[model samples]
Target: MFKTLSRKTVYQNRWMKLHEDIIERPGGIEGLFGVVEKPDFSAIIAVDNGHIHLVEQYRYPIGQRSLELPMGGWPEQPDADPLALARGELQEETGYVAEHIEQIGYHHVDNGGGTMGCNVFFATGLTFSGRNPDPEEADLEPMTLPLTEFERRIKDGEILDACTIACYGLAKLKGLV
Candidate 1:
């Protein structure tokens, strides 16, 4: 296993911290590694009947709006409950609350370069009220599509978010979907 010889925080913000590390490789050679440290997030798959709710919003870093499952994290509250985050994000982004939320699985975001993982939840029996999006997510639009259509979108490359794909796949694999 590679050993961390030294690590230094190069930058930090509310959302993430960037670190530079010197590592002793398996062959005993020294090398540098850059990592982004961030708190985990939760992704929710809200399904009611045959429909699944999703959020579409402009992802600034990617310079385009993308479709994804309701997801968010509280970097300020890293130890926050995963189910709470999942529930809140679903209602905040999609204006839907699930009568039941089941944690399907967890996945690392970028094991090679980031210290972040996400908890995935399978939600059923949704009820829509109204959205409570944050200012940054003011433009988010939510849509409910047939579960089969949602899966087709993923297969057709219309849904490109890795977390969303991974979460939904895990749920489906576990026979929750």
Candidate 2:
């Protein structure tokens, strides 16, 4: 088994922290590892009458806007419940409140580099309510399209968000879609 000989925080901010660790493997081999520590998040696949709800927002890191499934985490409340987070994100980003929301799967975001995972949710029976996005999501735009078109966009390279694709795949595989 690998062992951590020493660890230190390399960087930190309100959303995440980076940690550097010196580790030892079997046979005395040693190396350094860098890990990003972030709060777990939720991804919601909101479906209504053969259509899917998506949010388009400017992703600062990519320097462009992306169309993705409603998803987010409450960094300030790191210990928030996943169900509540999923419900909140759905309404906050897409302005669609789900009459039914249930967790379908859970998986790591980036097992090699980040200590973060997501709870994938399947939401249906939606009702429209005006969005109340956070300041960071000031540029958020919500849209709904047929499920077949959503899949086509993914194939056409228009929807590039990993979490969105993965969550949709999981829900589909589980026959929730």
Candidate 3:
């Protein structure tokens, strides 16, 4: 097993940190591992009457307004329950209160470099709730497409967000939504 000898923070912010670890490899060789430490986020598949709610927003890093599931986390509160985060994101991004929010599964944000991951939830029985998006999501637009269309978009490479696609796939495979 890889054993950590020491860890040093290389960079840090409200959302995440980069750390470098001095390690002993399984075969006893010494090496280093660079890791991004981030709090877990949550994604919600909000479904109602054969449709799914989606939010379109500009993602700064990619410089594109992309359609994706409602997702977010309380970065400053990493210990907070992911289920609560999912419910809040569903409400904040879509203005839809879910009468039932069930966690479907979890997925890593990026297995190669980051320890961050997300919990996926299947939300049902949505009711109108006033939008109160986070400042970062001020331009978010909430809409519903048929669930079949959402699947088509995924198969066509239209939905590029990894977490959104992974979480939705899990919900479908697990028969949660």
- Pick the TM-score winner: 2
Each candidate: what lDDT? 0.91, 0.94, 0.89
Q: Candidate 2 regions off by >4 Å? A: none
The superposed Cα distance between candidate 1 and the true structure at residue 162, in angstroms, equals 1.1
The digit string of per-residue lDDT tens for model 3 on 1-177 reads 889999999999999899999999888999988999988888899999999999999999999989999988897788889888888888888999999988878888888889988888899999997889888777999989998899999999999988888888788788866
TM-score of every candidate: 0.96, 0.98, 0.94
Model 1 misplaced regions, further than 4 Å:
none
Return the top candidate by lDDT.
2
Q: lDDT value for candidate 2?
A: 0.94
The clash count for each model shown is: 0, 0, 0
Give per-residue lDDT, candidate 3, residue 3: 96
TM-score-wise, the better of 1 and 2 is: 2
Model 3 stretches with alpha carbons more than 4 Å out: none
